[model samples]
Target: MVIETLPARLDPEEAKRVRQERLERIGSWLLPLLIMLFAIWLWDRICVWNEIPRYILPRPHVVAQTLYTDAALLFGSLLVTLKITFLSLLLAVIGGVGLAVLFTQSKWVEMSFFPFAIVLQVTPIVAIFPLINIYVDNQTAKLLLCSWIVAFFPILSNTTLGLNSVDRNLRDLFRLNGATRWQKLRHLRLPAAMPYFLGGLKIAGGLSLIGAVVAEFVAGSSGQSSGLASRIIEAGYRLNAPRLFAALILISLTGILIFLVLSLVSHLLLRRWHESALKQER
Candidate 1:
């Protein structure tokens, strides 16, 4: 006897879900863009109607003009700020992960120094910057230290949590297999802690930028090599509203870029195995 087979088809619900996802993604981008344009339009209309002075409330166009006119100078300052932010972030990762590993290795050491980490986290960078500036003669080093202070605690705490949260079963399996301490750590704990580390990294990136700005403001060092923060301060002192707004826009955009880049790195690293990076499926 001959057997007959028919073609398989996509379930109706699956098709509906696919279309819905596409539309949602499109709306997510389009709606925010539309709202931003509308707000800008309203701002321009209000400024025009109220006859506000440019020095007090410059129109969006005026800010755009300022951004373009000063792009070269502003971007150069932005590079300086970025250097401090990224250098801080890099150092925080190295120190945080190294300390976290040490803590995982020895409970006595963790108990001893964990309080100091908290103290650093809780003390406002502004309050600390004054003392740091007193001792740290190199201006760049001062900014780096302040930014690192702001970024360090998150990575250390999150990584510690992740290291301790590994599957008990897998740990037992490692023990049963007679795995050495280094082997178990390399094969099990570090992998489990990756997601937490990335999450902390995202938070650290933004905080580092904020710390860099705060340190710059505190330093108030003026010259050809001043960072964006210095430009903001200079604009404020000169009552240059347009320039101030432009500088703020650059900082905000930089923070956004840093966040997106870190998020992409996390997704790329975790997408194959981690549930946090996986999309839920019906």
Candidate 2:
């Protein structure tokens, strides 16, 4: 006699695992949010209990109010800062990938120019901004150049490493198949290099924002054309701590948004095929 198989239903172990993973993900976000709320409560309590002046350490509400009251000014400044950040990131991607391609084609080119890239990266933007300010007549150009300098090297290095990281066996197979150099690059090398390029892009995004802010700080460009860094400096001079905190919050949020967007991009592109995006269950 043969036994009949049971009807399909949820596996107890699999369901338990899924629920545990969901809780962990939710807790990951919730825990930090709860901590932040507690910190804010602590800050508000300290200010109220000690009668701390608004100029010294305004309550959280004051910072929120400042953000709302100066929304036009702060947002406008943020737009300028964002403009610089995005443009620099774009230029870095172009220049970095272009040079990395050249490097892949010729070892001599990599050896010749890679050191210069490293120099630009290692030299603090604060130091370079003075020279850039003097040499670059256009203020916007100076800011863009300063930002691009910091963002450039990561993309260049990562892409170069990716391009060269192709498996030897894959290259040999392509060669055996009579694949041309361009074909090998398009079909074999580029895909292998994508994760590295995306990784570089994510790093470059944050660096570009930092470079823009640092350049603005050093340049001390103010008035209508000023970026968030200028607002921060102006707030410091006026002893407007709430406004300073608000500006800082904007900058931090901008950075976090950039990173999240880049991370989403990486996940979307890689989820179908890459090991980095794959979910491994124990």
Candidate 2 global Cα RMSD? 4.1
Model 1 residue 132 CA deviation (Å) reads 0.5
Model 2 Cα lDDT, one tens digit per residue, 198-246: 9999999999999999988988853444899999999999999999999
lDDT of 1 by residue, 1-282 (tens): 222553366588867776899999999999999999999999999999999998888999999999999999899999999999999999999999989989898889999999999998999999988899789888899999999999988999999888889999999999999999999789999999999999999999999999899989988853433899999989988999999999999999999999999999999999999989988754
TM-scores for all candidates: the values are 0.93, 0.93
Candidate 2 worst ten-residue window by lDDT: 1-10
lDDT of residue 145 for candidate 1: 97
